[model samples]
Target chain A: MKTRYSFGGDEHVYVEIDEEMSLEAFFIALSLRNAVAEAEIPGVTEICPANASFEVRFDPDVIAPEEIMARIRELEHKAEVSDKRLETRIIEIPVYFQDPWTHETLMRFRERHQDPTGSDLDYAARINGYDSVEAFLEAFHSQPWFVSMVGFVAGLPFLYQLVEREKQIQVPKYLRPRTDTPKLSVGIGGCFGCIYSVRGAGGYQLFGITPMPIYDPTQTVSYLKDFMVFFRPGDIVKWKPVDRAEYERIEAAVAAGTYTPRIAPVTFDLDAFNADIAGTNANLMEALNGI
Target chain B: MAFKVVKPGLSTTVQDLGRPGYFHLGIPEGGAMDRFALRVANMLVGNDEGAAGLEAVFMGPELTFDADTLVAVTGAEMPIFVDGEPREGWSAFVVKAGQTLRFGFLKAGARIYIAFGGGIATPLALGSRSTYPIGALGGIDGRAIAAGDVVPVGEATTMTERSLDRSLLVPVSAPVSLRVLTGLYWHRLTPACQARFFADEWVVAPEADRMGYRFRGGSPMEFVDREQPFGAGSDPSNIVDGCYSYGSIQVPGGQEPIVLHRDAVSGGGYFTLGAVISADMDLIGQLQPNTKVRFTEVTMEEALAARAARRDRLAKLRAALA
Candidate 1:
C-alpha cells in the first residue's frame, strides 16, 4: 500500500499507511518504523508506530523537515512487510469478564452510555448481532489481539483484533467521558481496546478486569525490572477468560510475585497472512501452544 | 547553600526545557509553561539556557536564603522584596544570607519563574529536573514545594546585572495572538467551524494548567460527520486514536478548545484542529483566566519563519547579556 506523508509541524512527520485499520496496514507501519529505527538517521529522536499510521519526531534545527520527508518517502517504497522476519512475544493475559468491580462502575455511569437502560455488554451484544451477552464474550476472546500502540497513559496499550474486519468486535465510547476507571480495567471503544494501568478519566466502554500489573512504578516484578511497562507496540495479547475463583487465585499469585506471563516467540509473514488469514491464524495459534 | 521555603506559594515547582524522546512511553514532555521566560531568567543570572528554575503560578513564594546569591524573576510581574526593601522583577537582584524574599498578590500575569544564580541542584530524572506532578518522578521529590522545604542549590556560578533590554522580552500582557498552522486535521472540521475557530476571540478558561489551556468564548466547533471510521470513537470529536502533537487544540463536546502544552498528552481520540506554532506557545503560557486571544491562521512556511524570528530574538538577548 502507498503511504501518505504529511507534516506535523516543523519537528514531526506523520505517515498514514492506509485510511482503514487493517492488519496489513498495521504491518506496513510497523515495518517502516522498524526500518527507520534501524537506519539510525541523525537527529531522529523518536519513531512512534500507531494503528494504520506512524510518526517520526526529529530535531529540525539539525535535519530540515523536507530532508526527513524525502528520506521517509524513499524508505516507504523500499521497506517491506512481505515475509517479514519478525521476532515477537504472544503473552497470555488472564481476564475476569463482567467482574463485579467493573460492573458497578459501568452501572453508575449509565447515563453517559448509548443505552442508559441496558448494561454495556447487553447493549454491545445487541448492536454487534450477537445472540446473547455470553456469546459476545465468547467471540471477544475467540482470537488474540495485537498491540497497535502503547500510549494515552503510562503502560496503557491500544490493541486491535487479529481477526478479519467483519469478524472484529466494535462498540462506541461512552456518550461522555467517565471521571474515573479502575486500575487494570479492560476497556473497548470502537474497534480499539485498552487496559487502563492506573485510575484516571477515560471514555472507553468498560468490559472486564485484569489481575496482573501492566505498569509498576516501583518495578517490583522481575519481569518489569528493566522497564515499568509490560507491553510494547507489536506485542500480542491473548485474552483468557477466567471465573471469579480463578481470578482471585491468579490475583493472589501476582501479588506474591509467583505469577509469570505465558509468552511464545513467533515470526509473522505479512504476505502469507494476507493470502490465507485462517490458515495463518491457525499457525500462529499453533505456535502459541505448549509455551 | 540552599533556600528554605517559608511559604511555598501557589503551584511552585522546578522546571527546565523538558525531557523529549519519551512520548511513546506515554510520558509527557513536562517543563516550564512559559519556556521563553525561563530562558531569559536563566540568561539574566549567567546560567545555561536549560538550567532548572522555579515556576510560581498565581501567587509567589516567600523564601529565606541560607547564603547570599543573585536571582532573576521573569514571566508574571510581581513585587519581590528582600527582608523589607522592594526589588524589581524581570531583572536580577541580590539576596543576602538569612534574608527573606516575599511578594504581594499577583498584580499581572498568571505565573512567574525565578532563576537562581546557580541552577536548582535537583537530581535529574530521565535527563531533566522538570517536575511532572502526575508521574511523580522529577523536581523536588517529584512534587510541589512545601513550607520548610530546603531546596538544594549549586554554587554562585557568575556575576549578574539588573535587567535585559525591555523590548527584547514580551511584556506578558493579555489579548495575545496565537499563530496557528491549521493542517493536522483541518479536513475533519466543518468549513463553518473552521471559519468560526479563526474568526472568534477565545477567552482562557479558569481551569487552565500545564497540561492544557482550555479556552471559552468561541463558537462551538463542529466536525464534518459521517460513518465514524473503524478504531475511531462514536462522537463527532472522535478519530482513530493517534499522536496528539504538542500544542494541538482539541474541542471535546465542541464546547471549548483545549490547546495541549509542554506537559501535553502524546495521543488521544479527539479530532484536533492544529498545533499552535512553537513561536507563540509562550503567548498562551503566560495567559491568565479570562484573557482574550485570537487564533490567526498561517501557512507552515510562515510558522517556520516565525520560529526563526524567535530564535534570532533569543540570540540577541543572549548576546546583549553576554
Candidate 2:
C-alpha cells in the first residue's frame, strides 16, 4: 500500500491508506486504527478511521506532530491486516423500499435533483444500465455491504457493497441539497449507501426508509443504552427488504422497546473474501441469523 | 438564581469547552466559538475555564436578573447597560436584583461571551453544556433560550468591578489574515489555484454560521483532471468520503471556500485545500460578514509557535488577575 501521510495543521495527522476505496484498503485502515487505539499514545485526542484512510487528532503541546506521525507510521508497519482475523458484527437492517415519507421528500426536492421529472430510483436504475427499478433493487440487495465509514451526520453509515469495483453501484448527488429529509431515510450518493440519522438537510438520492432508529438521543433502544449511535466503521450491514405489514410490525416493536437489530459475530478474512466472493457471502448470510 | 429573557438576540446559546472524543460518532465539538473569551469571562466570575456561559452572536441578549449576581462580558465590543446606565466591555460588574441588563449595537467582532458568576447551569449532555443547535443536543432544551425563558445561574461570590487589559482582546477588523497549513488534498489541485488561493482577498459570505463560514471572491480552483475513482464523485472537487478535521477548508464547485467550524459534521467527501491553524481558530468567530480574509500559508512549526505564544499570553493574564 502506497500510503500518503500529511498534516491537517499542527493538531491532526491524516494518512491516506489508499488513493481509491476498496475493502482491502478498508481492512488495512481498520487494523491500523485498532492498533493505534490499543497503543493509547498520550496527547492523541481522537482516532477516526474512514473508508480508505484514517486521521488522528492530537495535542502538539504534549507531543510533537512529527513524533505522533512517526508513531502512526510504525503502527501501520506492524498492523498485519492480511493475517489477523478481523472481528466484525453482521447487522440485519430492514428497509421499506420507496416508503411514503422518503418518496414524498424526494418528490419535494425534485428541482434540486439531476432528473427533475423522474423519481430518484428510476433515474438511478436508468443510469446504472438496469432495465427496470426491480432489477436495480435486486442488484442492490444481492450482497451485503461493508460499513466503511460512519459519518457526515451522527449515526450515518457509509456502506460500500462487498463486491469488486466493476460490480459496485454508482450515482451522483443532487445538484443542490434539499432543505429537509425524513428521519431514517435510506439514501445513496455516488458509490456509497447511507441512512439519514436525523431530519435536516440532505443531498443523497433517497430510496427508502428504515423503521429501526440508528440514532437515539434519549437512549431508548436497549443496544443504544451506552451510546446513541449503533453502527461503527468496520461493521457489516445487510438490508432486508420489508413489506408494509412487516415495516409497521417493526415500527410497533421499536415503539414498544422490544426490538433490536439482528447481529452475529463474524471474522472478516480479506484474503479469503477476495479469493471466493460468493462463498464468503454465503458464510456471512449463514452467520447472521438472530438478535 | 435566574434571569428572565427580555429579548433574545440574533442567536444566543449556552456554551462551554465542548465534548471532545465523539467525532468518530459524527458528533461535533459544538462549544464556544471564541473559547479564549469564554475562558476569560468564566475566570472573571471565579469559575473554571470550562464552565458553561452564554454565547451571543451579532447582537446581545437583554435580561433582568431575579437575584443579585456577578457577571462578565468578553469578546465582541457590545455596549452593555445596567438599569439603562452604559458600562464598558471586557469587564465584570454586579447587577442588582430586578435590574435589567440591556445590550446596544456591536461595534466590532461577530460573537460575544457573557459569564454569570456561578455559570449557566444548563443540563450536561455527553459531558458538556455546549449546544449543537442543528442536532438539538446540549444547552437549554437543546436550543437557544427564547423570550420568557428563565435560565438558572449558579451560586457565586460577588466582587468589585474588573476590566481586562487591552492587549488580551482580539481586534475585529477587515482584511483579517488567517494562518493556514496546506491540506491533505492540496497536491491534487493545479498550481495556479494554490497561488491564487493566497493572492486573492476572500470575503465572508452572508451564510456564514457556526457550522462553517463560506468565503467568496477567491479564484475558482481547478483539480488535476483525472479519471474519477469509484466512490469519488465526478466533480473536480470531489474525493472518496473521509473524516474532516475541524477548521478544514473545503471548496465545493471551486466557488465559495467553506471552512468548517466547531459545530460541524465530523466528516464529508469534499476536497480540502487547507486548515486554519489552532491559534487562529478562535479568531474565526470574530470575523463578521463582508470581512476580508487572506489565507496565509504557514508551516507546522510556525503554527505551534503561535499556539505557544497565545498560551503564554493567557497564563500572564491569569497571573495578573491573581
- The fnat of each candidate, in order, is 0.45, 0.78
In the range B1-322, model 1's lDDT, one tens digit per residue, is 8999999998899999998877887877888998889999998898888999999999999999999888999888788888879887778888989999898878878889999988999998788999987666588877899998999988767765678778886564446888887766677788988998999998899979888999899898777867876667667777777777777888887788899988777787887777788888877777889998899898878888888898998899888888
TM-score of chain B of each: 0.97, 0.98
Best candidate (score: TM-score) = 2
How many clashes in each structure? 0, 0
Give candidate 2 misplaced runs (Cα > 4 Å): A80-84
Expressed as tens digits, the lDDT of each residue in A161-208 for candidate 2 is 987778788999888879899999888888999999988988889899
Q: Looking at model 2 chain A, which ten-residue stretch has the lowest summed lDDT?
A: A77-86
Report the poorest 10 consecutive residues by lDDT, candidate 1 chain B: B167-176
Which residues of candidate 1, in runs, are more than 4 Å off?
A80-85, A242-258, A274-289, B159-161, B172-174
Work out how many backbone clashes candidate 1 has: 0
lDDT of 1 at A143: 81
Error of 2 at A290 (Å): 5.0
